[model samples]
Target: MAQLIKLEDYVSRYEWNAYRYPSQFIRMKQDNWKKLYHLWRNEAFVGDQQQANMEPAASKWKSLFKFGFRKTAEETAKNSDVTDLPATENELRHYFLDKLYPVQLKWASSTVTEVSFVDQTYYANDRLKYFLKRFPDTFLVMYHPVFNVKKAPVDGEIILISPIGIEILYLIEKQPGTLITADGERTWLVKEEAKSETKILSPLLALKRTEKILKSILKQADIALPISKVVLSPTNHIASLKAPYNTKLVGKHAYEDWFAEKRNLVSPLKNHQLKTAEHLLKNCRTTAIKRPEWESDDNSVFPNDTV
Candidate 1:
């Protein structure tokens, strides 16, 4: 069985696990802030594997463990081993990679390196954080919703399969521009200047690949729910291109309406699954450095590490 990782609520760990970028972690763990914080602080290990201290019946052990904490419930494991949180993000690779990770990594590495990039990235993250604060684990998936993989199309990243929730596909533009998609034509508007189109990765396409991988993973878990993918834009550049394919290219201004209007989609995770996934992603190591703290949670422990 997969080793079950426990973690406390983020709010509890607010002092320790500071969010360098609020967009990623804040988007999902907002509501659980108080409880999560307490959990993180009060975490204790109760098994040989040394997982975090989880609430009674909070985490469900998986089906693939060989021994140790996965085997016995000694109830005296160390705090490091028995957390109320999930596994660190470094553990995602062992699970699998979805399609979105590679593309986002490329974007973060190549395209995203400017004031404008930081601005929009923060904008999207802000929107996510807003929802998280209001809905907590009910609306959003665990942090990252999609985890990144090292290799693309080869060592497929495992989708943390469970039930369905909102899966957002971000299409952050690197420049200021507009898009034209009235007819079958697609073009770009640079600084209000129109130009023939260039081939770039569209959030719409990313959604397709993510959907394919998620479908396979969900099926394996016997989950039949489908996640809706929306194209999120942090700036007006989203208007420059024509989305000829089936895609929802939404601007920041309309983010709330889009997210709020989302009907029929809901998260089915119990308290335990949500906590497990949330803990797992929080520790995801990203080469992407912290941008700046748009708003302060005021409970972060790693203040110097983040803005």
Candidate 2:
């Protein structure tokens, strides 16, 4: 019979830990600010001053600094706007940090480094996961599988490995506007107001690039699998999204029906479906760095040294 494997069982430790970056980054920022404040205080108050005056000033500064820091962190955390909080440690990590890790350094290097996203893509993915969990025999759903393409990392939000083919889902959250896109265009038009329209990056093109990278990775494994792209909008409606014919543009309400119909069309070869699932699980698992064996001559290397 076809067997389903949860993401935790199919992925490596590295991939599982990748999602912790968001929380870690937040903590690091807070810590760094405190360190900076202490350093500044040490340098600024070098001269001899009354202990009473110094104590009051330090207390005031500390309280103000803490209030500001807490407010800022809370805002950052709330910015995710994900309605469904993750239940497991792995899910929570991925829910908060997966999207940020790949581009965190890039944004950090930029002149304007405030990274914010309106789309609740993670929320959409979680909803899909909730639905897929019901069928443990026919589908293997992977969430946010990151791959290295030409030395650059690319993230595939959702990958459904089935008997028919591999369906890659790109989640787009609801926007406060009417969205319109034209095939072959890199930018999409969003009309938020009656008189003004803004251009945003095309999710279709992003899905295509993700597909290309995924294909390259599978090719390296000598595994040729049929692949298709899907744009899933769980909370938004596209007024006019002119996507390519090959791409499946689906909305939240229609997804369950569409998935059921697709599942029904699959051939009833249970054993074949199981084999295909196993093959993908084996090849698509992220590569984790192995610890080096302890030896006398291995002083130059550490226990976590990986090839």
Candidate 3:
């Protein structure tokens, strides 16, 4: 799953320490997956091995563990808890998707803030799921992030930071089989199945704005990384007379290939990658309240130095 480093202007634990949390999240995810696999296979572990395997994720997220990741009892009741052990492989995947994935996202995005998202509604959002599940962990995404450019806050499209570079993605989702014609800088024509057409504000405008903001930040930081922009639509066919230079246009027909290329990329987390993310995050506009308990109970909220 791609790490959701930032969601809008929501506070993130990643924002606290980009270098630390990404590696920690990867470790936690791997460990949890291994536990799930063993449970699914019904493999017997001897003595302490079984105990260790059964340890709840609360131990991993020491800070948010107290509030139980801030989920209400009713919300928690919606899905089978991970400890119940899934009976089938399909159920196992769903368990991870339904239970663990949200926790990971919360751990990555919100630590000291109250993120108001209705449980079922937020979980069922297809766009959020696409960013989380379709890409690898090495890819860190900032969804609709707000960046502080020229001391003014500017909203941006999805910013994907990979080991290789950064990609600004503008998603243009429409009704299935809708035809999108990109012909103007101000608006694009969307033709639905009934042949009714409408002009919507071009996503390219936002993409270019985001690209410019990132470029300004990167240039000031004296950090160099390949920055690319992509106008993506997974369910609509995009027809463009002239493609924009230094940008990719991925419509429905080519979505799978583009997605596969990202998933297939194999690379270790690089220093520059984290550094770029850190620089960008530093310039983001964050609105969050400090966790009340942290005033006196900082120890519980933070991992031990040894960790």
Candidate 4:
């Protein structure tokens, strides 16, 4: 899963230490998975050999210990049934993907911070889930972030910082089988089956505005990073006379290849990537109150190597 480094202007652990949290999150996830797997294996061991032979099943659960929830495993397992245990490697993996993924996203985005003050809308949003869960862990995302420009807050599209470069993404969600036609700078035409064509304000306007803001900030910081703009519609087709000067248009046909290329990327956290993320977080407009406990004993809650 891609790490949600920032969500809106909510206080993020990444904002506390961009250089450290990514690696720490990866370790935490691994450790949690191991703990859950061991618990599952132990619960699966059958005590009665005759019953085990009669059943002949690989494993049977005595309890279902919810792995990634905020509640402790013992608490979550109270009402769960023995039949819910994952019996195979694939089943266990799917269980994690379905249930524990949200917990992982939460831990990566807002752990060790005052998450209550943050808006809860995006926590259940499908679009945000698509961005956070569909990409690799190495990809750090700033979802619908607000940046400070000349002391004015400016909203931006989704920005993804990877090991090698930055991607400014504008996701267009239209009905499946719809065709999106590029018009001029101000609008684009959308064609739906059995309905009249309509024009909507171009997504590029927002893309350009965000690009300009990022460019200006990076310039001031003297940080040179490869930046690219993408107009992506994962479920629709796009038709363009010619590609825009520096932007890439990705629609349904090419979505798989584009997605595969990103998932295939293999690299450790790069120094430049961390530096760029730190600078960007510095310029973002964040709204959060200090946790009362932290105010009393600030150093006590800082995340450690063990997470």
Best by TM-score: 4
- The clash number for model 3 is 0
Task: Output the TM-score of candidate 2.
Answer: 0.46
Candidate 4: misplaced stretches above 4 Å? Answer: 40-82, 98-100, 104-113, 292-307
- lDDT scores of the candidates, listed in order: 0.35, 0.47, 0.74, 0.73
Using alpha carbons, what is the TM-score of model 3? Answer: 0.80
Alpha-carbon TM-score of each model against the true structure: 0.37, 0.46, 0.80, 0.81
TM-score, cand. 1: 0.37
- Relative to the unseen true structure, what is the C-alpha lDDT of residue 281 in candidate 4, on a scale of 0 to 100? 89
Tens digits of per-residue lDDT for model 2, 125-154: 445434443333345455555554555545
Candidate 1 runs further than 4 Å off:
1-135, 140-164, 173-177, 180-198, 237-246, 261-307
Q: In candidate 2, which residue ranges exceed 4 Å CA deviation? A: 1-128, 134-136, 150-152, 175-184, 193-195, 220-224, 239-242, 252-256, 262-307
Q: Pick the candidate with the highest lDDT.
A: 3
Better of 1 and 3 by TM-score: 3
lDDT sort, best first: 3, 4, 2, 1
* RMSD to truth, every model: 18.3, 15.8, 6.2, 5.4
Q: Tens-digit lDDT track for model 4 on 93-170? A: 555554444554454345454553644454456777766667877898988888998899989999999999999999
